[model samples]
Target chain A: MRYIKNPMEIEKTSFEIIGREMGEHNFTEAQLQIVKRVIHTTADFQYKDLLEISEGAIEAGKEALRNSPLIYTDTNMILSGINKRALGTLKGNAICYVNLEEVHKEAKEKSITRSMAAVEKACDENVDIFVFGNAPTALFKLRELIKEGKAKPKLIIAVPVGFVGASESKEGLEELNIPYITVRGRKGGSTVAASIVNALMYMIVER
Target chain B: MRYIKNPMEIEKTSFEIIGREMGEHNFTEAQLQIVKRVIHTTADFQYKDLLEISEGAIEAGKEALRNSPLIYTDTNMILSGINKRALGTLKGNAICYVNLEEVHKEAKEKSITRSMAAVEKACDENVDIFVFGNAPTALFKLRELIKEGKAKPKLIIAVPVGFVGASESKEGLEELNIPYITVRGRKGGSTVAASIVNALMYMIVER
Candidate 1:
């Protein structure tokens, strides 16, 4: 707020404000951290109610981070916003394959969204965490792959915001029996997804 | 497709793909450029029909870019994604005041979104182009300020994507006489907003 040039300080100040605004809201520390990051990104407090954090998603995320699992994101902004230094310490890599030729070719061949193709490609990469911030189709594809036993990620961050397939994709996540952190309706993006990843990074390494 | 590392080359390749996909569609050259960038970012060809580019918006944007006018954005990602090197060559700056302390304080006092407060702050900065990617509230507030004769921007890029006020906000943009590039429904974000800016940059300087 005070012309904060240091990214870490800016992030911390945002969390403090979020903490103050969330007074009396009941949530676990890890869930609260994710909520704070989401609020920090959108400045929308309704996320306090809309955000659905699974009982052990944060724990799963932390364990995945500790094991240096690859983080596959649906958008480059999510990849760019992650705490790279902290993740680097854990040997984790934040990867996004949205614009690759293979993805485009597969999407065309399979009659699917490029986001879906990207998720399919990510399945071959040993993904530990799947972060779908901008693409509901990607989240849907991930859910399908997980249910079919073709992919097994420790955690899923599904927060694709849009009128089309956003709510339904998150609903699909709920039925997967897999650990996930998601919002119920259409209210998320790369920024929110990246913030969740940062929260996980902080809990696993910074905290 | 070929693991293109050069940003310009990557952009050009995207344009090529967009050109192939848009074989029979009739659009002005400027409109095609904007559409290409939007598709490049989202990988969604449906944008061909969803996006609406005003006849004068690109011309207005190119003029503003050439004049080194101040650029206002709704999110940090939009600010960061802009080609700063080209902008610096033209002596312009991409500004996002949403996270500033002043915006947070004013938003609290006014019971408005920080994005709205940030737009109010930009009123004093002589903003030439207003790019709203993530905040419908910000776009709504800007419209209010413009109607009240409190602020005047040469061009507006209204593409806020979400379920809430996204469509209604873009509808508000249409009522204004100033030129704008907007989507009809709920589909947009910082990535699309940044792509529009990048397209304008390429048209003005990169080419």
Candidate 2:
């Protein structure tokens, strides 16, 4: 008949439950924060095993956050899920070009997804961080851009969720010689992607 | 290296994959649409067994959509994920009061969550449909309001995702003699909740 009513208490208790359920893991402090936040956003504890963080990936993400880096997301949902108030403290902004007129025109011309076109458009900008949540093609395109030496993001958070090419695109990201974090399967979403960014922001800003 | 590039084709292919993987189901035509869309958004097939829809729930939702309902959401992420173009065709609008000043004041005043406060504020509005995605407290509060005869909605899509009170709140909804659709456990999110609305809109508007 009763439960935690305060927002902070609810979040605190949720995290506590996550910590208790997860028990012990080999994740570093920063990686644990990202994993915990992801698991908190999604009640699935499988993220503990599915999430793969490259060596120093958290450090790279945190360093980029310290700078006023531009965070590019594949979907507006991810852009909406991000902690804007936290990003604002560091003078950073989250952007989603999927709905842009130029991106739409390019997608139609190339017969590609707007997600892919948006990533292509982002290649021209000074994007320091890339977050792909909805489209595998977007992650694949970003990997292609990186392979051609056109884009050099400090950190990439790729967790495109779907049955088609989601796992393969993340595998492509894992093969890249870049600092990145990704789920190893078809079990991630905008909420998980945004939670990672929020965890990174909270590490630097809220600390 | 090549895949479905056209956005419509990609969606069509994705739905085909879902249908193929799901094999056979006993869902009605309307229920199948909602289930397929949820599975499309989340690659998890457990939804096949997890989703619970009351009799005539889809009809209730469709009827509300036909009347230009004010769709109330618990989070901005869900409000952003909804297909605005489709909803616009029906003269329906999705609104989230989580960030409203009045809702914040009420939450602080009542010592409840902002999600619960937002639902309380929505109780005064002419809300035709209710969608709860991220907060179980909101669902519990709505169930309370309904129990007291304070509010009634044509259709309630309650799928609050978390480990805390998510399942219990949904169980509360099931106990009420109302037309509602919900995920049985802690396996739904804003994406799932928004996809249901989009599927319903697509059914009426695009068809």
Chain B structural similarity as TM-score, candidate 2? 0.97
lDDT of each: 0.78, 0.89
Candidate 2: stretches off by over 4 Å: none
Q: Could you tell me every candidate's TM-score relative to the true structure?
A: 0.59, 0.96
lDDT of 1 by residue, B12-120 (tens): 6546756886668888878888887777665556678888988788888999988977999988778866777788988998889977888889988877788888999
The CA lDDT at B32 in model 1 is: 86
Cα lDDT for residue A62, candidate 2: 90
Q: Judged by lDDT, which candidate is best?
A: 2
Best by the DockQ measure: 2
* Model 2 TM-score relative to the real fold: 0.96
Residue B138 in model 1: lDDT: 84
